[model samples]
Target: MRTLALPAPRRSRGRSAVFLAAAALLAGLAVAPAAHAGDGRKAEAATLHDLAEDHGRYFGSATDNPELTDTPYTELLGEEFGTITPGNSMKWDATEPQRGVFDFTKGDEVVDFARAHRQRVRGHTLLWHSQLPGWLTSGTWSADELRAILKNHVQTVVKHYKGKVFAWDVANEIMNEDGTYRENLFYKTLGPGYIADALRWAHQADPKAKLYLNDYNVEWIGPKSDAYYELIKQLKADGVPVHGFGLQGHLALQYGFPGNLQENLQRFADLRVDTALTEVDIRMVLPSDEAKLAEQADWYARVTEACLAVKRCVGITVWDYTDRYSWIPAFFEGEGAALPWDENLKAKPAYFAIRDALGVRPKKT
Candidate 1:
């Protein structure tokens, strides 16, 4: 699971969003003259989630089932964020291990944890190309057969957690980096209509859950983001229930910052749908040094600032919030240290940067 989103700008944002930001700015200037540099003691007791809520947003992190048993890790996760996304529990393979029969055991653990912590849950995904159950992936099917299977999977999963989950990544990473459809199982079998149908089916299951199209590397305005912009506009025109767009802010230091980030988010806000950074983590080439860490911190702050600047951009969720269980080192060898917390759970420069970006300044002792 991951968080994806874009950068700043209200750009004809809703009246309420504009008013809140303006009011917060005015109040910040009155209380702490150095507002950009530091926030006032009003937020001294605030966790990352608290600071986000101050601006009518949420701060969240992704967690997997195994880590839930680590009391220390779970403690911090429960305390720090207002929302959570299960890294793998809610995925296709985990939920429906066998055909028709479903298993909600792993996903339920996360939902229960979130309930106990008073946190909102964002369903990682209802559909994706990867991680399908062996039966579904191995079996052959015609368009009609596959469509029914897909509808069942999406509806059953969405209906099961109806009120518990606030949003659903109805379809994940359906686009290629170059802006073409991924031609995945759904795409090849059912054609491009699969996306619209998936969203529709998910909505039917849980009409209230925000349906989203989630993808990585769409943080900036380019071919990929452009495709989503146009597609979303079309969906809205066609009376689709698509509610949000998720920019999986999986960034690397080597790649320069997305110059048009804020502008990109602004454009989407202009479309009147919500936006979010779903699986945020800025990784660097490893054997990390102070310079690299500082750079990563800056990137985190930039991303936070970007989200804050946009009105419909609702929230941000770091992939796991810590490097100890980071998916980077294993997935991308020779690369690691992607999270704000160290292996031992120590706050790194990136952590302070995010807190500061969220407008919190610890009370000087």
Candidate 2:
């Protein structure tokens, strides 16, 4: 692959003052050339796979993170992978940080980038327990107020981004680890109907976008998995506009990857909704153990292969493109290097492995 010039990072506002500094630093780093000579556009065009971007603080472009540039994103685009999942760009807190007051600046920028590149946008998480503002959980508002607030929030954000976004993780991580329904403020206040209502409202707001129910750990076919299966079945039976399922394949090299991921994904596809391998990344402990690195590569290949084999599995999205910007280290102490690319923007063995799995020859440009 030939080398390409990196674009200067742009600035974006965050909910907190601390993120402003972090975003600035990211912007600066984004423009520096991360690729070697003769490896810019030519090499990237050769080896690039059409995969989706995992949106988060690290994956945010140079503008959003001063240290990084839009070159990587453009490289990915050149590779023919045009879909992106806003890691957290459209989350409840980010979009509606202060209740009725909605913010679409960051999310819009991402959408605009996707549009400029002719890429598809996945609107992540219309509903989730984490990253929610404190005001919603204080239990201070009446039920009617809460319902009005929730309805307004969904309608406003969805309508604002209508047509630009192709799909949405309408509800995320609603089930608990123990296979029971998690008690989120919306559920506690609005009851089970809220799930259906949220979906209904989202469908009404943007009828074109595909709405999905996203969750982690459903890769396995055990009790927790059973709970999700039944929940979706019920939702479908109730005639909800739920169109897809997002399986977050956050794998670890130490523990074995889920035994029957293909079969599990197939079962969901049998329900007639598309499935996606969302937020995929295999983590390894630091110090760069070769054995673990090899294992991680193998895991990436297998997951990519599985997605390809599953006809309904639209695409696979890595949580981050490179290790330098991975959320694993900060979120999971001592864990690092959780992506197909290394921090220096070099392809790891996993990159080739994924290409092999996708049955695409590396470009010789």
Candidate 3:
């Protein structure tokens, strides 16, 4: 996280005919004011998803099973996003609480919602260090025993959701901040080879679905990202089926923005794997002021622009759309207001900034 001044907003109204057609779909919805809200600037009619689709990218948000019951929440989720991730439903504890019994009731709810809205789905995680079921974490197993268990879990989940989920975070947050592998249960029992094994099992279950290795704090070309660079390179060399890299862009104002984000993504693109901003949000110290909010907007714009600049960078997804459902304050003590929309579901400056980043150009008169 390094500090840098945000660039001024650029203005140009010329746009493609296709954009104008798509913007018409935004009519009647509560989209924020145009990039230039007042000042006689023409209004923007397209949703963030609509504008993003124009560039062959998707704008998405993560939704939990509980939030699906909220009508207002679901309405904005459907209208604004082109893709969705199940925040916790697809995790091990939720999907497979019992040793061999699998329950997909919650994950299915998210997939069903995504399908109804015509939005693609990103399967949040197949393996991770957190939120694991008590049975799996508490039990002791030999190398062979754990390997079998891991494979079975992956294949069952992938096959059950086959052809529904477009991408799966086959592995998540498996690296340490200093570029070493994290000693999670899988690693402790199965050692480093487990990474390749997990990716392979997931691929076997569904060859069509893209497999991604996701982590946080690796948004720049640092030791952590460097570890992934080498790991991915080795995976490819060994003919593993890894297809993408997910940089969970969880930023904090106190930490500053990631350094050389575009450059970092480009290096991964060189490995022929797709990249995405998996869980993006810029949180600030509590009691948010105008200056802090403005800085947050600039960070949002920068993240979007970084993704757009890279050819292989597929899309961007906020942790959730509004601060109403944000997981920040709950975990980080006093740090909240991390999303583009406020708790009331009203658009913040970050919303307009994201629209601008997505090429929401007004028509040239």
Q: What is the C-alpha RMSD of each candidate to the true structure, in Å?
A: 8.1, 11.7, 7.1
Give the winner by lDDT: 2 or 3: 3
TM per candidate: 0.88, 0.80, 0.88
Q: What is the per-residue lDDT of model 2 for residues 152-176, given as tens digits with 9 covering 90 to 100?
A: 9888988998988888888888877
- Order of the predicted models by lDDT, top scorer first: 3, 1, 2
> Residue-wise lDDT of candidate 1 within 1-365, one digit each (tens)?
33233343322212333233334433432121111213454565578888898888999999999999898788789888899999999899999999999999999999999999899999988899989989998999999999999999999999999999999998999887678998898888889899999999999999999999999889888778999999999999999999999988888877667766788998988988999999999888878876667667777888898888898999999999889889998777798899988898777777767777887432344
lDDT of 1 at 167: 99
Error of 2 at 132 (Å): 1.2
Residue 110 of model 1, lDDT score: 97
lDDT of 2: 0.68
Model 2: residues with Cα > 4 Å off, grouped in runs: 1-47, 50-80, 360-365
Which ten residues in a row are the worst by lDDT in model 1?
Answer: 29-38
Task: Give model 3's TM-score versus the native structure.
Answer: 0.88
Looking at model 2, residue 239 earns an lDDT score of 95
